[model samples]
Target: MSFVTLSNSRVETTPPVENNSDSGVLSPEPDASMQEYYQLQMDLLILTVILTGVIFVTVCFFYPLKIALNYLLGAVGSVVYLRMLAKDVEKLGRQQQRLSKARLAIFIGLIVVATQWNSLSILPIFLGFLTYKAALILYVLKSVLMPES
Candidate 1:
């Protein structure tokens, strides 16, 4: 007998019980909360790329020496900012990681800008940006792909 057998009067049929191992069946869509988180993460990843390019170009037009000094200051600033972010993220969650990652990337960008003044070091610093970009991209991607623990 079917687990979902119907009665005789004005009968309506109900679906069968879903088995856990049914891979052929389409799974349920992500819930609203998960969808929102995914959207937020995707937005951040795109924003990071756009901002990185804008900052790189903007720094180029500004005074090379001043940019170098500012960049150095930014590196120092990141140490302090990261400390605060680390605490906030530990206490709260991924929200603070976004802020922390942005600050860290900015600090790295400053280092790159400084290197531009010394042409010999520019290539190495640019390579560093690639790593920074990858870090941000992965952080954002992971946040989207994985469920929050």
Candidate 2:
């Protein structure tokens, strides 16, 4: 058995193996900005969930259950859609792929149906749609005003 001692006096005994034909080259580690970007993504997801819960609870007091549900559904759909857009943009690059018109049409259709049904309050639903953007703006403002050292 062999041991490798580290500067901190820790010993690692695992033997290194010779490269094999089946082994693939390892990818390089992610840079600091990439790590920060993913961290922000996680933070945004957490904030969205919290915001959705708060909106659902607060709106329940003034609106009917159905309306409140619709508002939550809209808000959740918007957040999912925005997250999808972000992922697409990241994967395909902004210049390579813009949001499709069909997606916009479908979203508009949802709003129209909700409005026509009269069971869903347009105001709350619209506010729900804006929830993700509001959260994002707050996050950006916080990051800018109180930047990490």
Which model scores highest in TM-score? 2
The CA lDDT at 75 in model 1 is: 31
Clashes in candidate 2: how many?
0
lDDT of 1 by residue, 1-149 (tens): 01344587655533223222447553345445545544554454455455445555566577485454353344334334434443444334323323435545555665656666564344334443453345466666776898582
Q: What C-alpha lDDT values do all the predictions have?
A: 0.46, 0.67
Model 1, runs deviating above 4 Å: 1-26, 63-149
Leading candidate by lDDT: 2
TM-score of 1: 0.30
Model 1, residue 149: displacement in angstroms? Answer: 27
lDDT of 2 by residue, 105-139 (tens): 53676678778986676777777777788778878
Candidate 1 residue 137 Cα shift, in angstroms, is 16
Structure candidate 2, residue pairs in collision:
none
Model 1: number of backbone collisions: 0
